[model samples]
Target: MMTIVVSVLFARSTRSTFPSDGSTSSLITHYLAGAAIASGVIVTPPAVLALTTYVLAPSLRHLFERLLLYPLFGAAALVFLFLAVTTWKPGPGTPTSNMDTAASLVNAAAASALATSGIIVTTTGILASNFWLTLYFDARRCHPYDHIVLFLLGTAAHIRRERHRWHDDNQVTIWRASLEVVAVQVERDAPLSGRTGLAEGSAYMELRQEARRIAAVIRSHKRDLAEAYSAHDVDAVVASLVVGLRAFCVGDRTALLAHAPAEVAPRVGRFARTALRLIPATVLIVAGILLPLVPSIAHSELASNLRWYLIVMGTITFITTREDLATKIGEAVAKVLLK
Candidate 1:
């Protein structure tokens, strides 16, 4: 329930950043990608167990034995709901002054496409979160296995560059320019009129659409910074948060200053924020690891009753700690192994 709710919230918040041409094909591509990620997440636990058992020690052999006991695979159904709520940005020359019939249709389709991609990302993350919980609890329930899946999904979603094209300096420049143009337009108050009425190729119209695109980009940037904060990426947070006071020109500095809220200033310390986020998951994972050592509670009736509860808690924490230190650890291990 919480997973679905969070998925919807995350999708809606970040849907505007997806690159779409307001076409059906673009939306379909995102949906397909989402499905692929979700499918991979679902099967990853068992696949990891099998591969690890064969290559490494057979310590996870018992996990495969108890796989059927817990019902841990049903998050794909809520994906469509998340996608349907997505809001996409329109084309470059979309007119905001007067709503044209063709422009409206284009905007609507673009919105749907944008929404689809956002929903796809959200659904994939949630499914991955579920996989993390399953791996953690399966071990706790005496089907112990390593959490390789968490690192894999986290690296794909948070660390990788190709997956998030908008997180670039060039893109940030475009966003700032678009926003400044729109700001100047709004300040003018008058329409883009000439000798007669409105101009045929009004610059305001293009700027308006560009502004919409920039708004989405800013929202996505803030989200990226927040995730970086959670993951204790202090350098990233500082670089992104502290928008330089000095710009090449006075206009440029004013425009940058206007984007303070969008830049999302750092409040809490990165280490403190990360520690807080990890505490619950750490306690859950640690308890799961150490519980079996104490034989009295390991097989007692109390343990049996709390087993389901603990699993539920573990799943919630897994979703909450989406891209914390665990992701960095996973990436480090991967680099070492690859070498």
Candidate 2:
């Protein structure tokens, strides 16, 4: 459940960075590759054990008498083999493009096989007689579902990108420009500080101060920023202010001055919507945590199951929440608190 939550968070955070059209297919292919590799690893130990035992049965009868020692040796051999195959990278100029179809396919297949074998040997043990079946079943319970969720997340991102191509492009441009400004400032100021530490000395303090100033500037210019975004007329001043906000978000600092409108309306409506969903989940989590503290329900099976159910439901709610709106709310809160 934690893994799923983290993955969903990561997918949403980075989705905007992926190329609009190709992101989904690229992500799906990667997940498929991972699944294939996992499957291969799951099956390799049994295959190795069967091969070695059957092929050398008569000769290895004496060794097989010491069951634990023999299996350990077999496992060691599988480990060595798995390592060799998986780490055998081809030459730099290897033809991996579509034009070299056969070579690509063969290379991909070999890599997948080696990865799968390596994983199986590493996790489930190389000996066929180990708890291979138990491990495989356990893996099946959660692994595939995680990959499927990742795939679906990628697909959703792709659909969103396509649907809002122009808007996304504009946002991307804004952020890119913001990043460029930040990079320039870092490059210019980093050397003056002389120290390279992220959390030390005058440079770091200066950066923090600058960040606070930038955050203040952004807060003051909220109305203008909103107008620019809505009207699609982002001027240099607004762009700079947005960059300042972005820089502040990423813990960067540089001083800049800007002017803008006076009064900004509350943008908490989105946060309210998100809170409507999150409130129940938060309550559920609180209830779950407090269940054990209650004398009457502490030892009850129903209480334990209810706690688990609430946690699961809360996690699901978190994953399904609208990431964009949540991110905006978070940014708004950050700005307010920083002020």
Candidate 3:
């Protein structure tokens, strides 16, 4: 199919019937874009090769055993390292002029975005390759389909990764679900936690109250709290109220981990939503690069847009989900009811 398309395009390019002005540039752009799409979507070499490697890796284990496999693994690792070093593009020859500076900035931004996409692609490939590698070693057989599927999954995963990172190219946000630290605080209340069932039940309620208080602080001053937690000073602030965290986790059933806030669940869920948005955006940008929808637009521009989109999505995902309360309820259910 790719050959047919290329042949048809090249055939058209040769005909005198097409206009001779900027039409040639447009045609060239289309041909190149289409070729890229053809390779990426259909005839991608890495995907095919990786698939083959995955299929055979298992058989190697059976034939050579672990002792003989070590050198082959090392050699393969070295080759991968070489490929990485070969592809590593150093920064542009220090942009001297204003136009050079501008172009350099654009390129820098583009490279970062593409690299992120590449990482994601690599991650997925790594996951798929590792899975198939395990399967091959486990089965002690070579299957072309298994290898091919690995390649497909890996390549697509790579592109998807790049596309994801591209969409989140700008204004990186540093945020966390902030649940783990909160769990520590909950643990601190453990000494008095055991008192809840007896006449001193008010102290147990106080621990729950403390949870609310900490939760409120998180909601009102997230940036400040985040900064504090980042510095590892969060535990210090509530040191007075929190008993030994270990006490709760050990003998105390009232420990935070066993009964941590159900609210962290929504935050986890939000991150999932952000990932959901990332998938289609990547597909769109890659598709656009291949299609060449407008003659004026460059494939690089489409790539650039993808980076910006990712940045926006990441920023939004990080911010909007901050101090999310829905997770608290869900966490409560999972810990108490589900358990």
Candidate 4:
């Protein structure tokens, strides 16, 4: 029953053309359904690849740890072989009754082998590639996805102030650590969380409380915080100086900024900075949403391809920009849910 329901949902989801003639509520429903479907499609491969690696890692740890791309290449070879077998067709021929019967049995066996091999090889290749890339990035201690995390969890307020600070030496680390610290505070004070909107009340209050906490921490280690913030790169411990400090309140912001140079502060307001960060993602989203509406492109394979391309590009833009899109979403949601 559940499987049938899910299948129906996915089937309906794929047919969505984002019709422009719909009522407002209908349009919203369609958009949300389409977005949900897209998110599932986008996330499924990575989830499967991760699970495959985890299940195989214990037995094949050495192979992945050392061989890396060699395993991926071997997997690719298997995939090519599977494809070759599946596509190979019997040549034009005439045969007796005995030959026909024998050929049918042979073909059945071949079909079974192809089906089994295709699944195994495809999954192996996907997991091998994912694991190799993960190891490659891990060795360098730099994960680009961290930028996405920063954007998702960051408030528009913080992104507005620290937009320029992103990707700088120790900047990602600083923000990540700060978020962890704030998360700890939120968790500890879970009972005290506001009854109103999650962000407007809870997150806002937490940011203020965090500001005071950071101010105290800085007072005792002013020189240390200053030196780390001003340096090109900071170690793990110092890197977590909480970038949120500067955005929470004027006093804390001033104290934290005192150590850094005057030129480091952003010149624009929060809304302007947030808008700047959103441009690429917004453009891609707009293009994706509107491309299929063109009469010339309607129902064509090119339209489908371009829409997927735009969707992927837009998603990448959102990821690369550190989730400015999500911040906007949170802000919008908070407004509706405000007490």
lDDT of all predictions:
0.42, 0.44, 0.38, 0.45
How would you order the candidates by TM-score, starting with the best? Answer: 2, 4, 3, 1
**TM-score for each prediction?**
0.20, 0.25, 0.22, 0.23
Cα lDDT tens digits, model 4, 120-185, are 445565666787788677646633223323332453335335645644646554554444434333
Model 2: per-residue Cα lDDT over 1-339, one tens digit each: 234333433433332233333445554454467447645554466456545653433222223334433454455346435434343333667655532433333344444444444444443343443555644675566432232223223322432333333345555444333333333333333333334466566766654444334334444433333344332343443345444444334434333423322332323333355567778778868876787569888776566666665565565556567667655654554454433
Residue range with the least summed lDDT across 10 consecutive positions in model 4: 260-269
Q: What are the per-residue Cα lDDT tens digits for candidate 1 across 282-327?
A: 6866675567457887876556434444444554565556556555
- What is candidate 1's local distance difference test score? 0.42
| Model 3: per-residue Cα lDDT over 199-270, one tens digit each | 677776665554544343333322433445222343332331233233322444344333334433212333
lDDT measured at residue 200 in model 3 versus the true structure, 0 to 100: 74
- Badly placed stretches (over 4 Å) of model 3 are 1-236, 240-244, 248-251, 257-265, 269-274, 291-339
Please list all clashing residue pairs in model 4, or write none if there are none: 151-322
Candidate 1: 10-residue stretch with minimal lDDT: 143-152
